[model samples]
Target: MTSDSAALPGERADFLQTLDTHRGFLRYTVRDLTDEQAARRTTVSELCLGGLIKHVSGVEARWMRFAVGGAPAMEAAEPGGAVAWEERFRMTEGETLAGLLEAYERVAAETDALVVSLPDLDRVQALPVAPWFEPGATWSVRRVLLHVIAETAQHAGHADIIRESLDGAKTMG
Candidate 1:
C-alpha cells in the first residue's frame, strides 16, 4: 500500500485525499516500465512518461512554494519556464522514470506540508505569468490547493492513456 492509503479521514481530509489520489495515479503511470520505455515519446507531442513526472513535480513545488511565500528550488526551462505545459511533457535521455517519480514524491510531500501548515485559506499568493493565466494576479491558498487538485487529476488521466499506449497495462493498481 502507498503512504497516502494510510492517511486517516478528518475535517480536511478531502484536501489530503486529493493529493494522495493524484500521487497514486502518477505513481501507477510509471510502475513496471523499463527506463527506456519510460522515456519513450509515444505521443506526437514528444511527451514521455518520465518528462510528465518531472513536470508535475516542478509544478507542485512551484505552487506550494508560491502559496507559502517561499521561492521554489526547482529550476525552470529557459524559454517556457517550469510547468511549461508544452515542453514539460517531453523527456530528455538523462531523466529516468524512476528518478522523475522520486522527485515527484519529494515535491508532493513538500506541497502537502505547505498545505497543512497554512492557517488561512484566504491568504493571497502570487502566480507567475504563463500563457493560460493572467499576469500578477494573486490567488488564495484554497484556490491554489484546488488548482493543484485539478492540474494533477488532468495529468493523471493523460498519464493513464500514455501508460496504456506503452503496453496493455490497464487498471492502475
Candidate 2:
C-alpha cells in the first residue's frame, strides 16, 4: 500500500490502492514513449496514450467535484460543450506526454487526499441530468470512487492496447 493509503481506514485505503494500481498500469503503458508517439493514433478510435491520461484526469477531477458538491459543482467546473469533449480524446497542439502525465499525477494526488478526508463515504448526491443516467438517480461517495476506479481501469486497458500497437511493449504478459 502507498504511504498515502497506509493511514487511511480499511475501505478508503482499499480504494486508494486499487486506484493507484490502475493509474500505475496506465502510466507504465506510456513508459519511455516520445510525445509524438504518445499522441499517435493506433486504432480507429481517437484515443492515444497521452490523450487517455488527459481524459482520465479530466474525468476524475470532474467526478471529485461532484463528490464534494454534487452535480452543480461538476457542471460549473468545466466550461465546455461537444467540441471540448471531443478534444479530450486527442492531444491538441502544444500538449506533451510528460505534461499530461504530470497533470494526471496532480489530479490523482488531490483525489487521494479528498478521499481520505471526506467525512463519510456513504454521503449521497443526486446525479446530473443525462439520458445515459436513470432519472432521479443518486450516488454515494463510495459509488463515485467506484466509478472513477472503473474509468481508470478501462482507460488503462485502452492504453495497454495502444502501447502494444505502438511498439511491442506490454503492461503485463
Candidate 3:
C-alpha cells in the first residue's frame, strides 16, 4: 500500500507491507479457479484453497476484534455457531474461491487500518476461551498481529502446495 493510498505511519507500514505480501501470495493460489477446483483437496490434509482463505479471514477478524475490544467483549461478538475442526478446512455450501478471496481482502484491509491506528502495539488483551490456548496466556495486540502474519503465511504455503497438486500452479517461483 502506498502512503497516498493508506495513512499508516512508518512504524505500522512495515507490518502492513509484510502482511500484504503473504496475503497476495495466498490469493494468487486460487486465481481463475471455479468453485469446484478451489474446493478440491489435493493433499491428504483436509484443507482446500477456498477454506484456507476463509479460515485466515475469520482468524484475523477475531483477533482484530479482540484488539479493539477486550476479551470478554470479543467473546460476545462471536458467531452463534461454532466451527468444527474439519469444517474449518473446507469450503462449505454456497462458497466460491473468488467470493471468499474478495471478502478476505476486505477484512484484511480493515485489519491493517485498525492495526496502524492503534496508539500502542504493546497493549495487551486476554485470550478468548479455547482449549488449545494456554489457560493464562495473554497476548499483546502487536503479538496478535504477528501471530496473524505467521498464520497467514503458513496457510499461504499450504495453499501453494494444494494449488500445485491440483493443477501444477505455483503462487510464487
Candidate 4:
C-alpha cells in the first residue's frame, strides 16, 4: 500500500523540488556566516540573513497551517502584534544563524511531509484577514504551496543581495 512517506507522485514531487531549490539558494547565501555576520544589516533596509531565514521559516509554517486548516489556524500559529511582526526581520539578542537554520530545516521538513500526505491540493480555505489580502478571498492548498514557493524565492533573492553586500558572496551568478 502507498504511504505518506513513499516517493511523491509527479505534481507533488515537482512542488517539493522547486521549493527545495529556492530554499537552497537562501541557505547557500548564508554559508559559513557567523551569527554576527548573519545578523548584520548590510543595507539601509532592516533585512538580515538570519532574520530572513527565521521569517521565511515562520511564514512557511504559518501558511502550511492555513493550507491544512484555513485562516484561523494560521492566525493561531503566529505570534501576535506589531513588535512580534517586526522581530521577524531582525535578529534579536541571542539569536544565532545556526539556531535559525535548524528551525528552518524543521519547518521545511514539516511542509514537505504535509505536502506528501495531503489528499487534496484543491481543497480551499478562506484567507486570513489582512489589508494585503482581498476581502473574503479563498485559496486552495495548491495556491498556498505556490505562495510558499514564491515567498521563498523572493526572500532568497533578498538574502543574496544582503549576503553579497556583507562580503561579496553571491549564491549564484
State which candidate has the highest lDDT: 2
lDDT of 2 by residue, 6-84 (tens): 7887999999999999999999999999999999999998898889999999999999999999999988746433337
Give the TM-score comparing model 1 with the true structure, all chains together: 0.79
Top-down lDDT ranking: 2, 4, 3, 1
Q: For each predicted model, how many residue pairs clash, with residues at least 3 apart or on different chains?
A: 0, 0, 0, 0
Whole-model Cα lDDT per candidate?
0.70, 0.91, 0.82, 0.89
Which window of ten consecutive residues has the lowest lDDT sum in model 4?
Answer: 1-10
Give the root-mean-square deviation of each candidate in angstroms. Answer: 4.2, 2.0, 2.2, 2.9
lDDT of 3 by residue, 87-133 (tens): 77789988778788888877887887687667898888878778988
- RMSD after Cα superposition, model 1: 4.2
Task: List candidate 1 stretches off by more than 4 Å.
Answer: 1-11, 70-87
lDDT string for model 1 (1-173, tens) is 23543363453467778777887887887889998887887767576778778777767776776777722322334223434456566666476777778778777776666656567778985566567668777788788778788887887888788888889686365
Q: Give the TM-score of candidate 4.
A: 0.93
Scored by lDDT, model 4 comes in at 0.89
- Candidate order, TM-score descending: 2, 4, 3, 1
Q: Name the runs in model 4 displaced over 4 angstroms.
A: 1-6, 77-83
